[model samples]
Target chain A: MEVNHISKSFGSKHVLSDINLTFEDNKIYGLLGRNGAGKSTLLSIMTNRNFADNGEVKIDSEDVSDNDSKLGLMYLMSEVNLYADGWKLTQIMKDSESLYGGFDHQLADHLIQEFGLDVNQKFGKLSTGYNSIFKLILALCLPVRFVLLDEPVLGLDANHRELFYSELIQSYSDNPRTFIISTHLIEEVANIISDVIVLDQGRVILNQPVEDVLAKTHSVVGPQKDVEQYTKGLNVIGHDMMGTIRANYVYGDLDDRILPDTVQLSNFDLQKLFIFLTNQYEGSGKNENK
Target chain B: MEVNHISKSFGSKHVLSDINLTFEDNKIYGLLGRNGAGKSTLLSIMTNRNFADNGEVKIDSEDVSDNDSKLGLMYLMSEVNLYADGWKLTQIMKDSESLYGGFDHQLADHLIQEFGLDVNQKFGKLSTGYNSIFKLILALCLPVRFVLLDEPVLGLDANHRELFYSELIQSYSDNPRTFIISTHLIEEVANIISDVIVLDQGRVILNQPVEDVLAKTHSVVGPQKDVEQYTKGLNVIGHDMMGTIRANYVYGDLDDRILPDTVQLSNFDLQKLFIFLTNQYEGSGKNENK
Candidate 1:
């Protein structure tokens, strides 16, 4: 699937600006962005739930707008609950099965038992965590080629979140497909996602494989002057200083310059990288509208 | 502050049962629990926002219920917005200052600048993340001795969450107080909290200093048979197996047992400990009310 020059605006605010992205087959992608970075809007446009002001979303070179067949190939489990409040979980699943087709009843039943969800209970009666669990169950059981999960583990506890990750991996292994997950819990999904797509102020800032992103990023720590000297010409996204010690977060390759005795280079995690990258962009004040 | 034999129920549902806990001054506590664990209910009861079916909450040997002076020392920043929808952030802060007294305007203004929050925006107009930031600013600037935060970073992004944690630590350092944070994001708060309290099925399952709990938990890994033999007669909370390899999570002291050549012991993190401990209690089928 491809998002080509997708731009959207609400009134005077530009939510997405000429956004372009490509999602390959049989891969897990982490869609990362700040609170108002237009992730949900982009997802909505891609799924035809919302229309974009410019460009189009295409699957296999065919535009997905108002295209039922292409739309059926993708499923988006977002935080919003669209089902009727009075509907029971089982009834909702049945409705989804008929509408989407190819629902895995066996997997759904297993998940219901595993999560201890009572299918007879009304949708509105479930707690926040259970509501998230129910949506996750549906997303996993559907036989869609692309599964987009937005805040999939919104209110899940540690045990349930672990279970969901394991189940997702198991399902993916059994039937490989594209899974694009957008969540605030970066550390938890860092290792789970194969590739990452980061959006900053409605623009695609970083899109690369997890391994490549981590390989290029480094944390240079030591005396403030020495660390700054080592990262002088590099892509230092941000830095932190505590008294005389400093740590420069670099997002690009390091030079062959001999390392100073006082400076040490170490790999940083995805969460830290995200924080620094986003923070640096915020400091630039490129998009003051948001 | 102490919670003595507190119990609460709503109609046919029992929310909290015989809960007992002590919050020491100048310390941070992580209150962890699964969905429907009655964590919110317990916090409400402790803060005198809700009534308990039995027992009482006391501070310095004085009943906190109906005692305005004692209750004034505590503040509960919950998910629900208590301010009027049309009220602006500045007005809300002013109201809090009048009601709570000793509101630190300097810290509040600094936080507003740091978080990039627009104080002129109405409470209802703020985005989810901004709303959380507003509540967090209030919680931090308040002069309460016991501040209870329920899902403080609910909608915050990676950068904002990191900032909140750092700001929280800084605020605590500047003004020594008790902060009992109840959140599902366990790993994030694991290091920030000095003590952890786990509630399961409306019952207090585990409560201990973070260091002490982590000191006793071990992850025994090896061949399935070897791992089982090594962990025999020990408090093995949970275990995972893949083919021939097995890992058993134990939560108690080792009895100086002979070590098998194929087995190795290592430390487990707070999240792992919480998962294993909660899962063990669930398997026992105690209470089963929730």
Candidate 2:
């Protein structure tokens, strides 16, 4: 799947600006961004739910606009509940199965039982967590090659989130496919995703494998002077200060020979790196949220 | 503040069952539970937003029900937005200041700038994350002695959530008040909250200081036979088997002198303990979500 120079705007406010991305099969991708950072807008444009003002989204070199075959290949579970409020859980499942075709009824039944979701319950009556669970079940049971989940575990509790993640892993292992998860909960999905795509102010700021990203960035902490001296020539992305102590996030390898006993080096988690980078972008005040 | 044998029900479903707990000032408490586990119900009842079927809620030996003076000391920031849609962010703050009588406008302004919240925007126009931020700013700036935050970080991104937690610690340290946070994201709040309160099926299953709770529980992992033998006489809370290996969670101190070299002991995180305990209670089916 490819998003080719996509650009979108709400009146004069640009939501996505010249965004370009490529998603490969059988890989889990983490689409991370702050609130109103164009993560959802990009996903919606790719799925054809919303149109982009410029450029296009294509699958297998074929435009997805008004293309039934291309549309059938991907499924996007968004935050909005498209199912009717009066519909029963079973009814929704049945309708989705018929529309999507090849829906895994067995897996759906198993998940329903595992989550203790009653098929007889109406959609509107479900709690916030249960509502999210129902939508996730639909997304997982579908036999689409590309599955895009937006805040899949939005209202799930700790145990339920754990169960969902384990279930996702099991599903991926059994049948490999492309999974793009966009969420605010970073640490929970950090280890599971293979690739990281970070968007900041409608532009793709970072797109790399998780390992490669983590390998290049590290936090070096020590006395302020020592830390600054050590990271002077490195690509220092960000830094934190606490009195005489300092921690600098360097986006390059360190020379072992120059290492001192007073300093310590550790890799930055995806969440920390994300926070540091976006903080810089947000502070610039050029790309404000409309 | 104390809840004296509080009980609540929704028609035939018992939402809260004999919940009796106490809250002291100058402490941070984590009110954790599964979805539909009665955490919100307890908070609502304590804040006088919802009436209990039985018993009374008292603050300093004074009944809080319909008592304006006592209720004035407490504030509940719930998931549901209670402010008028037409009101602007600045308007709500001013209204809250008049009602609370000692609102810290300086801190409110500082946080608004830190979060980059637009005070001119109407309440209904804010995003999910911004809505939470607005309410959180109010909760922090208020001079109320007891602050009850229900899902305070519901829609916040990673950076925003981190910022909120740090700001909360700063406010708590400066003012020294009681903060009871009800949330499903356990790991995020584990380090900040001093006490843990686990609600299961409308019951207070566990309520203890974090240090005491963690000290009593540990995970022992090793060969299946070795783990089983080691935990035979101990209070085994939970266990997991993986082929020839096993992991057992014991809720009592171990005699390190008698432990075999193959056996490894590790501490259980608050999330893991909460999951294990709640899983057991939920599987019993006696406290089902209605």
Candidate 3:
């Protein structure tokens, strides 16, 4: 799946403007941005459920909007309304079996039982976590080449969320499908995302491999004086100054000799990195919510 | 604030059974659990909005239900009718002032501008992030002893989340209050939490300081053979074997002599830790959404 030169707006408001990016093969790509950055709009357009004012979205180098084969290539926005509130979840699975070619009935059943979602209960009666599990099962079991999840685990508990990530990785390994996930919880998904496409005010700001992204973004913690001096020439991403303990994120390489042994170093906090980058580029002038 | 042997059941299903916990003053507490673990239900009971089938929730050594000052405690859920749709937010603020004492007018005004929330706009017309900011502002501006935030950053983008945390800390410093925040994005808020309480099946499983939890939980990476042997005596929190690097979340202070310099050591993933801990107590059955 891929999109190029996409520009969309509502009235005078430029929600998404001049966006160009590609979602390659079977890798997990993060579709991230601030509210009103047009993430939903862009996904809506790609899925052909909504149309874009301009730009092209293609699946397997073919226009997805008009092709039925490619139509089966995607699924998006999980607001489970299978027929009616009276419908049982098992009946919903039967419907799924008819819609998608790669539907795995056995796997779906196993997952249903795993999530403790009662097969006998009506879909409406299930708890929110069970509801999220239901969506996750269908998405994983159904045979789709490209899957898009937007806030998929809204109501999930800690246990269910863990299950979601494990199943997601398993699904990818077993089926080799492309997943485009949009989420506010960056740290949880950071380990899984092969690539990240950061959107700012409806424009694609950064699109790169997650490893490279992390390698370029580094955080160091040590005595306040050492941290400040070491980060002077580098692109200082963020700084948390609490008394003498100053933890900072810098976008640059470090020489071994200059790196002090007393300083404790760790990988960047993706959540903090995301926040600082978005703010540094778009956070200024805005009255600090802090 | 504290609860003694609370239990609430709906019809035949048991929502919460034999639950007892305490919330300390002038500190941040995390109320964590799966979606249906009665987190909301428990919060409702403590706030005096709902009645528990058994047990008592106390506020300041008195039953929560009888105290008029309980109104000072703010409970903000993701989905609720804070104000009627057509009413302007400014009017709602005026109304809020009457409902709660010690409301800060200055902070409210600053929050409105900081988050780009239009005070004159109708309440329901606002975007999700904007709505979150507005509600957050109202909760923080209230001169209250206790504040409860349920998925507070619902529609907020990455940048706004950091801002929200900063604002939260700043407010707490200005006026010491007890905060109980329930969220699934554990890693994002892990640093800010003074104490964490993990609930599963409506029971508290692991509750401790952040440093204590993280210290006892560290990841060991190497060949699966050595990794498994090295972690035999330790409580295994999580493990991931991918080709060459086999990582395990070992619970113990690992001896460096046994680990050797060749094996790569990594910090524990908190999100993964929450998942594993909950799964151990309960199960990781998939939520089978068809």
Candidate 1 off by > 4 Å: A280-290, B280-290
How does residue B177 of candidate 1 score in lDDT?
Answer: 97
Ten-residue segment with the worst summed lDDT in candidate 2 chain B? Answer: B281-290
lDDT of 2 by residue, A104-152 (tens): 9888988888888888999999988899999999899998999999999
Evaluate candidate 3 and give its CAPRI docking class based on DockQ: acceptable
Order of all candidates by DockQ, from best down to worst? 2, 1, 3
Candidate 3 C-alpha lDDT tens digits along A1-290: 77977788899998888888888888999877777678888888888877778888887689887787898878774553444787887788778778776578777866776676778888788766677677778888888878888777766766677777877887798779789998877877999889998887888878989888788777878888888777777777677755677777786576654777756777775666677777743424233222
Worst 10-residue lDDT window, candidate 3 chain B = B281-290
Candidates 2 and 3 compared by lDDT, better number: 2
Could you list the CA RMSD of all candidates, in the order they appear? 3.7, 3.8, 4.6
Q: What is the C-alpha lDDT profile of model 1 across A1-290, one tens digit per residue?
A: 99899999999999999998999999999999999999999988889999999999999999999999999999999977889898988889988988898799888887887788898999999888899999999999988999999999988888899878878888898889999999999999998999999998899989999999999889999998899888889988777777688888888887788899999999999999898878844455322211
* Model 3 chain A: ten consecutive residues of lowest lDDT: A281-290
Q: What is the lDDT of residue B59 in candidate 3?
A: 75
Q: What is candidate 2's CAPRI-style docking category based on DockQ?
A: medium
